[model samples]
Target: MNALAIENLSHSFGTRQVLQNVSFTVAEGRMCILLGRNGAGKTTLFSLITGLYYARTGLVRVFDMAMQANPSAALAQMGVVFQLPTLDLDLTAGENLRYHAALHGLPTKLSKARSREELSRLEVLDRIDDRTCALSGGQRRRVEIARALMHGPRLLLLDEPTTGLDVPGRRALEQHVRDLCRERGIAVLWATHFLEEVAADDDVVVLDRGRVCWAGPADRIAPELGVGSVAEAFALLTGSP
Candidate 1:
């Protein structure tokens, strides 16, 4: 079954339209890449899906649960890591995660256990007692991801997740999330502007100026568009020159 489905989603701020009739689906255990250049409305689309704000027009469903009509239930199954770093610097890694667990109504004992498990899986358990500010950039990112999974969410949404990481950090973070998706049967919507992150078999939706300009398996883009690579095809499809 589809883990996420967006139908005819459009959003606007007064006279400026941010997203125009965008639609897509992400199946369970699949990684769907929301590939768009900056300013293409990637974050805006994420906000809508996460119910930060209702879209001017559209329907968003998570595992067949409609966001508008059953918002709480729908959101409960989703884990999101936005473009910005959201962890409190003053809090220890474990504390931040436990706080999130508390918000989700998880018991204190279970929250601690999950926090430890998640951090361990991400190879950052040693930093659990350390303040978030004391962790390195890569380590902090991993903690944020661990925090997102504390509730065992079935769908994960990451918007520009690797923004400030080095090349190695970026690649490592990408692999970690991919592994999580496969192992947990989690559907993931990873939004990014980096062309190198797009793997050949990845399901990609190319957004341009608030619209979906192209979408399909990454490898198919080149072959079908008569281009040599995903980047070339992306440029052609989005008029990127």
Candidate 2:
């Protein structure tokens, strides 16, 4: 079964419709890139899927559990890292992770063990006791990701996770997340505007102004749009000049 699914999801604020009939799925042990520009309604789509606000129309399912009807069950199976920074700067990385694990009612020993495991996987185990504010941008992002996985959610949702990182940092973090899908069989929906983040093997969903302009394999996007490269296809589909 797919780890995440959306069908005909639409949302609006006042009179402005932000998402129109958005639909997609991320299967187990795979990564799906949600590609869109800054104003392409990617964040809004995340909001709906995460239940920050329920869409008036359509459905969101996590492992066949309806989000609106079975939110607790659906949400329990998911972990999310939003675009904005959410770590408590005063706390150490380990503390932040412990806090999250505690929220999920994990035992102390298990939380510590899992915290180490996740931070180690992200190559930030050495910084475990350091205050979050002192860590570099990349380190913080990695810590946040580790915290998100404290409960071992089947579906991992990341929105602009590499934001504010340098080139090497961004690439390293991206590679780590992709590795998680393979190693842990965690389904991932990674949202990003940067074309370089998409790999040939990934499933791709191109969102433009709240609508999906294309959906297929990463390598297939160019051919499907009749363009020579993914960047060219993005420009053509989104009319980005």
**lDDT tens string, model 1, 96-193?**
99999999889999999999999999999999999999999889889999999999999999999999999999999999998988788899999999
Model 2 worst lDDT run, 10 consecutive residues: 216-225
**Per-residue lDDT tens digits of candidate 2, residues 23-62?**
8888888899999999899999988888999778999999
Q: All models: lDDT?
A: 0.93, 0.93
TM-score of each: 0.98, 0.98
Distance from true location, Cα of 28 in model 1, Å:
1.0
Model 1 residue 234 CA deviation (Å) reads: 0.9
State the lDDT at 159 in candidate 2: 98
Model 2 off-target regions past 4 Å? Answer: none
